[model samples]
Target chain A: MTALAERPYGGSRGGPQGGSQGGSQGGRRSRGALALMLPALVPVLVFSVGPLLYGILLAFTDARSGRNTETSFVGLENFAELLSDGDFWESFRIGLVWGLSVTVLQFLASLGLALLLNQDLRLRGVARVLAVVPWAMPPVVIGLMWRLVYHPDAGLLNGLFGTRVDWLHDFSLALPAVIVVGVWTGMPQTTVVLLAGLQNVPKELYEAVSVDGAGAWRRFWNVTLPQLRPVIVAITSLDFVWNINQFSLVYVLTQGGPGGRTRLPMLFAYEEAFRYGFFGYAATLGVAITIVVLAVLGLYLWRQAREAD
Target chain B: MTRALKHLALLGYVVFLAFPLLWLLSTALKTPQEMAALDPTWIPRRPTLANFADAFGEQDLLGAALRSLVVAVATALITVTLALPAAYALARHRSAAGRIAIGWVLVSQVFPVVLVIIPLFMVLRRLELVNTLAGLTVVHVTFVMPFALWMLRGYVRAVPRELEEAAAVDGAGRLRALAAVVAPLLAPGVVATLLFGFISSWNEFLFALVILKDPEVETLPLTLVRFVGPEGVARLGPLAAASLLATVPSLVFFAIIQRRLRSGLMAGAVKG
Candidate 1:
């Protein structure tokens, strides 16, 4: 279904409307198209693209968050200071760990749930609705709901286990605890996408494999995994990007507490710019992290594309 | 035995997915004393409407909600209005610029928000739009624009060119054909995009946190976060109640999209 949905619209237009166009006629039509595009283009240029370019430039200047502060170009100074900034390094490492682990775990769990929901099972209707319910939730609310679960004394986790662990404040436990919530929060969309992919898999291939005396495991291993590869690559990379830049969820959950154990890159950048007022340095951090994330994503996608061939 | 095991596994997944929500519902209903209990029951012993009442009365939740509603509605309407024609152009009239527009949408999604928000703050401050709902609304509209355009483009592509061509043959101009033939066909997609924009703006926190630093101008998500005080148990019920209230719009959105997904108009929207 997703594969069909993703098919581009360029090839299918072959009619009186698509052809029989004169050169001058095509030029006039394109002019009209450009005029139609202008209203949306203006705001996107002024607000989105302009800010992004200016932000990269701001990384090299001494732009503090106050007026009367003279801004000057300080090329490599912020980067130099960032090199020795142990807190920034810690947060970067934590961000990678959080992003990678949560994404991997979320993919695995969602795959299992998606496969289960794809089955001809009872209560499928009820379970399917419950599965995607989290996608409807606000991130802040998901964080708060998990916070309630992970609370020390009166929380549900403690009550369920009859234990008294302060999950969010315990230095060693905080990251893992928050990672659980991350996995849970991201499962719904991942599951939905995977389920869509699963539904698109050819049933006849499974039947053929079954006739060859292949068991359930063999059929799934031979058919499902390869068929779902494109979707897996797309979703995991997207999930990684979303998880690493995540702010509001962890902000509400732990606020990067327990001595910055769960301080993802965005939270670290947020604290730097908003909490401590280091606009230039924070912009540098933001630019640096983006470069790293893109590099990682590029490498991953390149490998996946190679594998797909 | 294998069938039983599969059922058990499915049940386990359901419980894992639903338990936290049930816990939230239970917590929202419990009294302060029940909340403070060392052994919190899965079901509240004496459920009350007190927490909902308290949450409503405690903060300026209504004002924040109104602000959030205004921002979301404006963002949705403006985003769809701008996106519709652009989407039509991209779909029906392909150009190099259209390809570039799609590239921008994908690039915008991958880039970190920090990189954009810092310079945007400076821009807003220069215009003296900081701490204003209009500023936040502008930011929300732009933030949701790329995806809105992308999604609407898919919807536009779904409406066959033949319909518009037939309308053109009937002596209608391009704009008339669009209004008369394509717009009605694109209604479901437009609504989906609008609700998508509305929900995105409504649930937004990081931008609102930065832009609306003045508490008087805080949105619902910001105000909801404030319900989390240092004091723990006493504030739990009201926080739970308020959190639930904050989620109503999104739930309504999900309900609409769920129905659309069943009918097949929302597959591209979900992918976006």
Candidate 2:
């Protein structure tokens, strides 16, 4: 979802904040500009906006098919029902744990890996492209591949650890297993972003710190961390949002199984919508996800707006 | 860390990243005899291509791939074609409406695909597009258009304004100037963006699963997932084999555009 391409946290490059005032400023062709934009905007309006609003509207209606299969409006009934659903709350809790673990872990791994790649090591370029291999993989392929690794019998984890645990099936092990896979696949862009941030960090600052007899940790904490802070915060926050929204990987690996232990909110929403045909309930779940995502990203967007001003 | 230690750490990371892919490759080559063994082996004792053959035999990988290719290419082309004008306007012209459009694109990026997928599925069903490649392509266009528009806007912003102005000064219309002067310079960006569009379409799962129900019309991802038995056990060998094949196009396109992607990624960092 442009998550990979746009994973570079923050540097004010005219993203959603509209920092590009460099375009055509003439009054005569404002109409021309509008005309030019019409084609692209039309599809977004037709496909994206229309459905999003419809989905929200569906949330407030009796849109289920099982017992009460009417499309009549029932204001906040789905949401109120959702508030009391233990399964929804359980999914949300799992989602929070899942999202936080992946985001925090991915950030640390990406930062460390980025630092390693930023070093003047030979084959760093090769490593750079190879690092992208995981990111380039289809999420489904990743899920399938990881499922084998987590296989109960003759799995690689078993071979490596001398244990017979069914990683994706064991209730205690399922979420962690899935989290590790999530971190693995989500590593590339964050690493790239941090690596870029590292490379762009002026060399003179490093030399200056080194000349002052600073150790590596001191230098990093004093120089690198501060320099990378905005990027770290930005990427980490976006990663959190992405992790919360992730569906395919977890769906593929466990299908939110092992007694719903790994049923993230997305999978829950999906099951509610497709599996049970609870459109209204599922739409409420969708709205909940959107609100969570917006809340997560709202901070960054607000900052971007302030910066744009 | 010392240079040796740093390289050691880096090597560790490379192993971490490469291990799963290596395992997938090795698993695809392992014979059923090797797979059935109680113990796992690092290298397959009797590496065979039979799993891939079996995978191909089971599902029409070639047909599904063809469908995927048609859909991905169409999505990329249509998205880029539509986004080009929008990107040009967004990049070269800063009006209030244009700004709002950019903002909308940003919002669309984070808008849950699930919310839209249901209704889009309904709309496509009504239009008899539920199982067609064309229908799948249109759905993907909506998914990718915002990203393409924003990314290409960044690229279009990088193209110097003077080139278009120079052509316009010589009696060329604005559109002609854009075509003659700006389009050539945008080649690398277009390639990279199109590659991303292709990858997103090819890798997409939920929309395809929801919309395309016919086996004959299923994409590679759908076919691959169908390998799961009703008992819910995935056929690991054949699944890995087919997965490797499905991933080849994206990996190839990735390599083709790696140089641009590195640059584009750095330049394209707008998704917060």
Candidate 3:
């Protein structure tokens, strides 16, 4: 679908429209298109690109403890500070673990669920809708809900097991607890994508695989997995970006608590900028996150290109 | 034998997904004494809607829900309004710039809301739009526009350009053709886009949390968060009830649009 849209058909069709209506009508159409695009584009540019550029600028300066206007250039000092800051490095490692674990677990869970739902099973529609509940819930709500579920005293876990475990309070358990919520929140969208991919795989191939005495696993590997590669790449790349940026769940659940053990770089950045008033340092972290996201995207696109070839 | 195993695995997966939700519903109905029992059980000992009553009375959840609905509906309307024409142009106009515009839409989704939140905070504060539904709506529209455009663009492109061109040749203006002819065929797409945009805005938390500081303007999610007091102590029964209430609109929306979602998926073949 996307490929066809990108294909260039020549300028000959332009002649009919061009001759019938000279510059004025064409100008009007272009104007109309611009008008339609401006409302959407302005907010995106102002909020997204504007901040990104500002953040990048802040990373190179010694902007601390004031509005952005008070900043002066300190040329890579923030990045240099980040390089030596063990806390920053530690948070980076935590972010890496959070991103990779959540992304991998989410992909697997969703893929498994998608494969299951793709089968000729009863009540598959119900399963699909039910699965999307987590995704539909706000992240803050999911975080709070899970926090309740994971609470030490009266949580569902404690109630079910009759043993108290501090899921979010324990340093070791905190990250995983947050990651579980992340996985739950992300699984639905991934499942939807994978289900779409699975549907695209022609049924005849599966039938053929079965007739050839290929088992379920064999059929999946040979037919389904190959067919789902593009979607897998897309979903995984998206998961990486989403997981890297995840803040609400962690914030609401732990606030990077138990001595910053659960602190992902995003939480670290927030605490630095807002709480600690280290705007330049936070901007540096934001730049680092952006770099990692772009790198992951670059890698995914390259893999997608190779897969296409 | 393998088929049995596969079915079993699926059943297990279903249980995993459904159990937490069931627990939430049960907890919402349980009496406080039953809920606080040392040996807790899944089924409520004395099932009642008292918890729900308490939740509403205690939390002002009904008001928050109305605010959420207003924001979600406004965001959906504004996002679709802005995205439709651009999506239409990208669909019908075969140009290099149009292709780039489509790709750019995908790229826009990659930037994290957290990165934008700080600057947006500053921006909104500057405009004196903070803590207002209007402010949150602007943020939601910006957040949802990319996905809406991407989703609708594919569906719009699927509607044969010849149909709109035929209408144009019949002396219909582009806007008239789009409204009278092209739109009816693209109803499924429009619904799907609206559902996606609506849900995205409806579920969004970060922007709402940062922008809406006024308690009166709180969205459902933000209000739900108020259930948690300092040090992570939460009022479970009320929280569960509010959670269930918060989910009602989305579930209703999903039920109404599920058929359109399916057809849109099949037609566009875009996973979105």
Candidate 4:
């Protein structure tokens, strides 16, 4: 009985020791991975997540500029005010129009351009390089350049037609002017993505369509469009997000102006916070805009996921 | 008939793309009289470099350009440095968490910089970093890092792990194998990421406008804005000249990187 109990106890102890060692090794590996990840994660958490959370918190408080002491818990007063403000609603309308027009125009133009460039044509390389220039330009510079071109006197547009018309100063034309610049600046990446998609399409398929006596239009509609559906969806979704968030072009060109003609949601938020000193209201706008963007993005992502299966 | 129509359409598009740039160059070279002339001419009569000189003289354009360069280059370098290791981990480490991390980086790009500007401004103000080059660089790196990580992650994943493993078996550590066996192969991707980050940072305006309020710390775009204040009459010739000068660095940078932006590099590298 003594020998049997001693042997069993010794064996159990040995087994536990081995298991503990293995557990320690696993723990060390996980710890090592966490250590490697912490440096990258810390800044993102502190700067990215921290500020976003603070902005959300500030939206609920009566935060103001200058004194910084006026911040008190105002509850949903900011949201109610933003909801009632005609200027905020106008800005939202402008943003919606701006986003829709820019996305549609840019996507179509870029898709066409990409398709054109994908062909085995002379000067394809040169055209591709030229296409990227507008996108590479600073939005402020683009704004200023277009503003110059749209100037009533001594501007390129008026000069070309020999008819002076105020582009920015006119309420009707200001939003359209901003949209044109948006399309120009956003075309390059969409073009590149579509071009990549086009290249992925097999040559044999095109040849097969040709053998079936399909013309260029028929081939493009049947073969190319289906092949490029994924890319089209991706680029359109990205363009929407970008257009919705755009601030620099509108800021520099119109400053939400010509009697508040081109005020985007972001521009309105900026003016409220910085120009008008309504931090809480501005934060509400920010939150609203964020929700809108996420909804749009979420829809696209869900569709993509569904299609992926 | 179809071919003719296609050619006409292509020509029209090309003209649309090229006209604004051509007009800018023309305005820059035109004499003040020519620029202000009622009759618009495609080419400047009595073209002169006086506008260019005036643009340089009227503002610290050169100094601003230099500052922009420093900020862009520093941001690119710093972003690439921080992103490289993280990208490697994301690409090579096959796990659920790694996938989530990669997705987060992509999602972060969608956040408008304007939303975070208030907090960033507050932080920078408290740190006494506003209006400083370092402040701008930090803001730039924060903005550029997500995209750099996304792009570089794709590139790094393209590199074959077997090559690194083979090197590891020959008595090299993981870091050493990464440095010697994998990095050289990733040169194109590295260049692409660096160029993309640099250009994006260089062109950034909103943060620069709010943060760099001091005239001494102003960038090219801000300086150009100063040329067209509400009170002052717009100097069409000088402003056009200045705008042209501002575009030069980006144009040059894009030209340099255009050749390296082929599609199959990532797909080919990963598959091989």
Candidate 5:
């Protein structure tokens, strides 16, 4: 991922020696660069970096939402509370289930669609357009539309199945129902990314495999899988992070509803902050969730990179 | 047999992807009686535009839409203004600081808004900017800045340095060279970035949810969510119609960007 940005461009206009040898010129150039950067950097520092640091500190405090509330340091106390918080553990478990299942399902579904789109097939343009149209959709609209689909009485899901199942409200089905929406909403990008990766694979490898008497499945396993691994790793890790951090889609779909069945980690943190107004605790929740997700992601990416090497 | 199965699989995907959308369009057009029927028809027996009319007539729908438009336009303008020069710097100057900036852009995407937002809310409250569209616009700018920078930098890189150097050799100053030599070349990228920023801000929900507490300031997505409250089937048609309407800007965005998107240049821009 970093490599994309680091792909060396053409001549550096101001070389390293240009500064020291042409001292005044270098100083002026440096000042100009800083000036160019400051417009974007200042807002990022104030609104993003500063708040992010303050939020980390807030995780160690007792900062509530009210104006008159006394704020005090409560180092690791919230963490202690979090450890014993049964509701939180339940929500975290639900979050893992939601994140893992959605990521996996989205990957598989998108891979299938991407592979199909990469084929020499008729109506390819129309299919490609249809596949990507969802990428353009607002998540809120996607959520609301799916809610219509899963509506107990008036929903298309019930109408098609000829069975009355309150998909989003059912204790057993709500998670799966929301997972389907998550997959649908996420498919276009995953498919597009994977399709791009697929298109990049050398056709000669497929020819070599075929000449060696490899069947289609064997060719895919040996040739396609190995070649696509980097893109797979990048996109899937991103998908996992995006899935766990997903709030708006699930929020609009079920509002963590029918007993918080659809509450991903981000949704859980949102509730802590907004619904209940426990600002510090919410920050703690957010921090804890990020550490865990990053650790998992780091391990996964490390193994993949090592394997690639 | 395999070809038939391939066609079948392709058809299945197309149906899976398109069905919900078609269903949404169907719901928007169905009459109340059709929506209330025991069995829902794929095509409405009695189609009507009344639902679309009702969607507009709904309380605050039009106002909320206007608010959404305002925020989106402001975000697009501000995001491009900030991202353009920053992108130019990152593209031209391969400094350690530039590398760090790129690293920060990637890292920023990983951090949860929940983490930043709590402290941000307090900061905004102190600034007396909470519950204001201006505050919401600022947040959207930061939210989109990373990806917009990434995209615009790519576009900047796509414009070869020779052109800028040629302009420079002709006695154009740095800013002059950029404006005269680079800006026109970067117009499509600028428009793409603007559309992306606009769509993201227009569709943003969670930040707006936190920032805009007053119903009077609620954006379109917030207002649309309100329509889905436990009011039952009475509100379904309008909700569907409104949902369909909310998708228009993004559809137009996609139509324009579809070719560039297929080039895979903007792959990293979307969250998922």
Candidate 6:
């Protein structure tokens, strides 16, 4: 933290200068600050907000793909279809399963790795970057790598283990296989966040508890858990959001195949819009996915707010 | 756990983490017959570079890679240029409007990229950027700017505002004060954000896949995904070769600068 403000003039020169700035200067500067903000706001509104509002409008229309389909206004027809659609509901349920499995498992494994890395081990620097290899890889590449490994023939998983299992194609194993890769590629962010959180926990708390005859587990429970709650909350919330929308990996790995068992909501929507020429219906799916993601975020913020109170 | 056990566990992690890349390397070097051999050797008994020759020669990925590079560079340049001023405002003003902007950016992160695609595609179509690298770069600017701005905000906050004030007190103009005082200290964030924006644009697939219909305009990721058609999975050797080629730049970049990235993120976490 000190590295940020480690300027030579920080402590000594700051106070004397503030006194010379008159009230009139402050007013002009605040307006100038707003002017400084203008460029970013313009693009954010144009590119981000404008497209988003247009997307929401698109969801309520009959904007199907291909030349034969006409673009006409429809009031929640897409949504009503989604409500009764069996495949859509199935994907939603699987989306929750996929999101929870990846997020929860990713968080636990990252915490464990973070704790290990925090220790003064041999080759600590090497281990740190090694763990990040998968995280740094593009999902398309990672998905392909695993695709080769999970092959039933000429495959390492089967070759090394002496078993025959089609990891990506099997009905029961595909989702789990996808989730395992999800944890592998998603670990670095959580580890970095938790490690950052771990540093904030004071050494004296552990020392004082040790003197009171507290064991390692007790110190961890009393000192570590309480201190890391907010960070944990933030990281897991992000993990859930990320995992829920995961598409490219699954798309490359299985394309939501084996009867759509591993099809995430994003993949489902992508297939709908692009594959089946159902652009309007796909827009509804996208909105539904957003609502679920926003709900997850909303719940986290609410809980955090309550905790702060 | 005992210290020996701890070291052993670390070894396990290293092996587990390194295995896939190792396997990929082994595959990339193996002969086509060896890849199809009943008993695949862990080590390619006779290594070959023919697959890479095929990938670069026949598939012509060099052109696709060059296209990816142009898009990545453009995305990084535009994102950093815009993000610097916006992040500066958030760091300096701390007004109610700034808070709302930050919140809005965070909320945008959770919104599905799919939602952005349809509308973004229409806009790009209208502008005739559908298959153009320029269009892909513009779309990436929107996708990447929010996170870049947020991270830059943290880095900007870490810079002491007084340093700029001290320059302004010397009768320097506002732009001159920023160029002199803030820009140098802003180096770490800029470099980090640049790498981030570059890597992200290089790796982006969905929008590029949608917007760029013609093979001539395809980026690296978009071209790579084409290997999975009805032809028995692009032949493992060529696939592995292409993947490794695509993998090196971002992986090396991450290994080098992850510490700076972590510290910047932690600073942001501390504030939140």
Q: Pick the candidate with the highest DockQ.
A: 1
TM-score of chain A of 3: 0.85
Against the true structure, whose lDDT is highest?
Answer: 1
Q: Which residue window of length 10 is worst by lDDT in model 2 chain A?
A: A1-10
The DockQ figures for the candidates are 0.53, 0.48, 0.36, 0.28, 0.52, 0.52
The single-chain TM-score for chain B of candidate 3 is 0.91
Clashing pairs for model 3 are none
lDDT of 6: 0.82
Estimate the TM-score for candidate 4.
Answer: 0.89
Estimate, for each residue in A1-309, the C-alpha lDDT of model 1 and write its tens digit: 321453455453454544766888788877887886676467567767888889889899989889668899999999999999999999999999999999999999999989988998886787899888887888989998998888887699988888889999999999999999999899987888888888889999998998899988888899999988877887888898889899999999988888999998899999888888889999999888898889989999899889888
Candidate 5 chain A: minimum summed lDDT over ten consecutive residues — where? A1-10
* Predicted candidate 2 versus true structure: per-residue lDDT over B102-139, tens digit per residue: 78876765656667776776668668788888889989
Candidate 6: clashing pairs of residues: none
Error of 2 at B53 (Å): 1.0
The best-first sequence of candidates by lDDT reads 1, 5, 6, 2, 4, 3
lDDT of 3 at A48: 50
Q: lDDT for every model?
A: 0.84, 0.80, 0.75, 0.76, 0.84, 0.82
Give per-residue CA lDDT, model 5, range A230-300, as digits (tens): 78888888888888899999988888888988778888898888889899899999898888789889998
Residue B26 CA displacement from its true place in model 6, Å? 1.3
- Kept native contacts, as fractions per model, are 0.50, 0.48, 0.27, 0.26, 0.52, 0.49
Lowest lDDT sum, 10 consecutive residues, model 2 chain B, at: B263-272
DockQ of 3: 0.36
Candidate 4 local lDDT, B9-71, one digit each (tens) = 556567767777787788778887876678767788788989999988999999999998899
What is the model-wide C-alpha lDDT for candidate 5? 0.84
Interface RMSD of each candidate, angstroms, one decimal: 3.2, 4.3, 4.3, 13.8, 3.6, 3.1
Task: Quote fnat for model 2.
Answer: 0.48
In model 1 chain A, which range of ten residues has the least summed lDDT?
A: A1-10
Regions of model 6 farther than 4 Å from truth: A1-21, A66-70, A300-309, B268-272
